[model samples]
Target chain A: MKRALRLRPKGLEKGRPETKPTNDAERRQLMTAEGEVRGELRRLRARLPQVTGALAASADGLVLASETDEAKEAEHVAALTAAALGVALRLTEATGQGGFRELLIRGESGYVATYAAGPTAVLTLLAEPRINVGRLHLEARRSGARIGELIRGALERPALVPRKPNRPPSLAGP
Target chain B: MANTETALKEATTAIEGAVGAALVDYTSGMALGTIGGGKDLDLNVAAAGNTDVVRAKVRTMELLGMQDEIEDILITLGTQYHLIRLLKGRNHSGLFLYLALDKQRANLAMARHQLKRIEADLEV
Candidate 1:
């Protein structure tokens, strides 16, 4: 945000509270971005009744906004989502399956699905056991992308640019 | 598709000079299935020990910000070859196939070739 706002002079370091959007207009803008993301989650629920709950978090797993009944558990869910993400990213890379786009995990009781909202955010959905997975994916992917945009807007971050995939420099590095 | 039991059996029985083989879940360091290890080889111990090797490599990749995944790792000793092949695809994430062979009698190239073939058919 500090970078995006250009409030601080060049070479100014971190830890300045003034860098935050403290002005009323700036704060409203940030809230609106957050509101839009949460709204998208709700709209997704209405479209796909199978989606019981959903939350959008940063890639590091900090919850930006959520629309889930299990409010108290949201923290743990985001943390675990991040952990699962680490494994999923590695799993995809290891398989030469390209970059991770989404992940689906089905338990006997229900499904825990996650999608890449953007380069820096993730969308995780909790669904009932009887949910239509295909429909869920269809709806969630769009919502994930929308939420990613809102998040990037709120944070004033630039869009993700695909980078050239680089192979490991050497296997003997360790 | 190959099940754990049959896969272990095949790797041990078919891979020339293979003393032991195990389908290891590296996340838990548990040998889900094992075959052909006696007191000298200790497939269970090898499975757990090799988990460290896999983990170290994974961490190194992260630190280096590498965009590639490991296909397999080979370690050579005076009289043995330790092969650890990471399972690919969605279903078998966090799992690896471990095989121990008598280096003197085992053909490293052929061993890798056979491992790749078996890995393709392995379902778990």
Candidate 2:
């Protein structure tokens, strides 16, 4: 994480010495912002023993931070969440329910709950079937809101630093 | 819900491995009377999601130019079978019945048969 963050500034600092230090500082800030989001996920897991995994993903299906066992599973889950969200949004609109806030899907063995983390991100949780759903919603909703704020804060903080336009066709894990 | 609530109830209790059932307005993505969702799902919300499932397939079939009436749409997940039966007749127009089942214990063919029976016996 640090290497990539540091490398961006060096690559851009061929002649632009005026903005180099501040950009480096901004990258450091971004890394810490990501760390804070991870910390929130960790704390959420501590609170809910039934929570097997937690992931934050952009609305467009990019993995922001994954607390799952496998990186590939996290990426797949994030992408699937984006696809599912599209349908859920349409369903809500068709029913005149306004925007979607959350979606909870339960398979035969377990549960996959997704909370809308603001407008641009989603927080997904994998939990055991036996978990208390009311409590899961109570806790996940709070964490989802916090992660949203933290992420949005990071994005806004680097206001001058325009986001890289070259997003990968597939996920480039953050 | 008033007339066929019993029918929806029977789907869960009578059908082996039945998880849930709902009568949906696929046109509006609204659930009529949802019951017995697998694990902890809100059957109403799942029903709405399934509306898109039905729509997407119908649209795909149209794209492929397969001109046939849809009878049943089956979605097989790792551990569950989602059986959707599109209702015929005038009163049941633009509607579909959704049945979710546990894959392990479910007799898929029998479930389909029983669901067809429920559909035939459906009042509204």
Candidate 3:
């Protein structure tokens, strides 16, 4: 019999924290951009008949937005995407295949696909088995590019504040 | 129902010119079971490496807005054919079967047919 091993790599759940905006203006701008991203995801789902779920996550596995009803499943899928992305990036680099593009996995019942939305985020979709592959790619690519821009723009905003360092207690004199 | 290991071994024996076969979890990039790999072809490494291929294709499909199920992924080389068959069924999600065959002795069509049968019978 084939051995089934359940393995979870170290630090797989350690997603990078989003940058904190320095002031109210920056925070408002970031919020607006995030709202736009969510709207785009919703439209993508609405336009695609076979798409059962859609999620946007950071490269480190943090879930930013999800259209699925199952929040837990979305979280798990995001983490898995991050892990798979690591391997995909390395494979492309080692084989001189240029940059990572996308990934698709098909099963008897449905399909799961991951797209590199931008330099820092990934977009994943779940769809039915009978969905049209060509259409899925066409719409997803356009939406992914748009999402990438929104996310990258938010990340590049100059109003982010550096995290404060912890201070040790003074022991020299009381 | 046949187990994954039995199914893997059966695949190697039933398919002509098969050098190695493995059951891999693309989510974790780990091989659940393997048979018939040596110095020239390491089943573990192949299984892990192929996870990336499966992932890349899935990503491409999403980006292109193509909604379709992948039946199998075939990679052809000078002397070898790498076949990746994604598993279906509720219990078999997130898994795939990887088969490597010597191009000279294997019939691609027949091999794919046999692998499909094995995949159907495989019990996760």
Q: Which ten residues in a row are the worst by lDDT in model 1 chain A? A: A165-174
List ranges where model 3 is wrong by over 4 Å: A1-32, A158-174, B1-124
Candidate 1 C-alpha lDDT tens digits along A67-143: 89877777789989978886876676678676568889989888999998766667899988756554566677778
- Candidate 2 per-residue lDDT, tens place, A61-135, comes to 767788899999999999899888767766766786765678999888789999877655779999997565655
Off by over 4 Å in 1: A1-32, A157-174, B1-124
Candidate 3, A1-174: lDDT as tens digits? 111111122243246222211344533434446677888899999988679999887666767788887999999999998788778766765786765668889988999998877655678999997665655766787788888788657655554455433211111111
Q: Could you give the candidate ranking by TM-score, starting with the highest?
A: 2, 3, 1
What part of the reference interface contacts, as a 0 to 1 fraction, does candidate 2 reproduce? 0.00
Candidate order by lDDT, highest to lowest?
3, 2, 1
The stretch of ten residues in a row with the least summed lDDT in candidate 2 chain A is A1-10
RMSD of each: 18.3, 15.9, 14.0
Give candidate 2's error at residue A139 in angstroms.
0.2
Q: How well does candidate 1 score on lDDT at residue A47?
A: 81
